[model samples]
Target: MTESTHAPLLTVRGLTRRVGTRHLFDIAELVFRRATAVALTGVNGAGKSTLLRMIAGLEPAPGATVTWTEADGTPRTTPLTPLPQALRRQVAYMHQHPYLFRTSVRDNIAYGLRARGLPHDEINRRVGAALGWAGIVHVQDTAPDKLSGGEIQRVALARAKVLEPELLLLDEPTSSLDGHAREQVIALISELAAEGRCVVMVCHDRELINLPGVVRWKLGEGQLDTKHR
Candidate 1:
């Protein structure tokens, strides 16, 4: 593998999925070359969340191929829906209302790093950085059940940030927050994309969709269309 100035980091070819008896979407030849945020939107029940989960490497579909091009131009292929465990760690999926553990904010943010078997000192160091990233350092000691909805979302963001995933899948991140909280999350989403992370968000917010470097896509009629935005 050698470094290439122009090469997509990932490619999905001949992708298809079945939701019960109906086909989920028609996707073919999709490339993720830019670090900009990709905003997916459609009517309710359009399987927006479903698509994100699949791309995050959940249940796999046969005949669907997902290939990733490394920084050095090496290409690795796998079933898009069921990425290998190690590759899966490079992708993080966050729910509309992400679940928080029954522990302090610090612990929640440290979960992924700890799960990866990092030393205690390293985990602590990363957790502190994550808290700062999400602007939740002040609430590092707060329990999940005790925090407000906005705070919980921030904590969840911090937890996900700690993993340093290349692909961040967000399911309606700002749906349950107030105006101010929504702004905060939006800002962070933009920041993540600008920092060279591939961010795909399921959001209906007009403002969020129009953020700088955001590419928009519509999901409906049982198809996923790229290069149409």
Candidate 2:
């Protein structure tokens, strides 16, 4: 497909979510352009996490259509009530804290591929490459719980990256990291976007507001506004 045919990698229309009297995201429509990184910025309780979760299909959000297109040109929209299993596998969401399996870091990265019927050798190769990309190769065989906060988060990202999802949803991926670790995480995200993966990150920091080639969207008072740069 040419650049002109690069339709939105993700589209949300008339999205709304509420927890009792609290309104999270009341977006009318939002489109995440193909091969671009988009940052969701707002205050602490401005529904950043909630919006990411909705896009990832982790929870029920109201009146929204979430669609993802594969490189092969197949596209799928969100289904009512029950989400298709194939769509679920095409989207990966990373939480603030990486939840590692009881097994080694390698096993955690291989979990998704194993479930998808990939061979053991393929899983090993993919996991190794992902670990190297995330810059956590030194701890490939170590247990996750014993790793630092940044290490754990990187491992989680490695796991998701190995799956090669069409869309990646991140919620505060660098929240618990120090200066150097934070930069590493941000750089990794930039690299992913450059590789033509659609990325949506929930961030409160100002540094991301001016990230090169990133579309910034802010949520406030139950509204969504674009601060395109």
TM-score of each: 0.92, 0.89
Residue 220, candidate 2: C-alpha displacement in angstroms: 0.6
**lDDT of candidate 1 over 1-229, digit per residue (tens):** 1112535656778767777898878787766654758889999988888777777776565677888766576778877656766567778899998888898999898888988999999998989888888888888998888888888888887788889988788999988887888888888888887777778889998888877567877888888765445
Task: Identify the leading candidate in terms of TM-score.
Answer: 1
Residue range 1-229, candidate 2, lDDT tens digits: 0123567766667789887988766777777765777788878888888777777777776567766676587887774224456667768999887678899988899999999999888988999899899999899889977888878888888899999987899988887887877888888888888888888888765665467777887788888887643
TM-score for candidate 1, please give it.
0.92
Q: Local distance difference test, per candidate?
A: 0.79, 0.79
Clashes of each: 0, 0
RMSD of 2: 2.7
Q: Give the TM-score of candidate 2.
A: 0.89
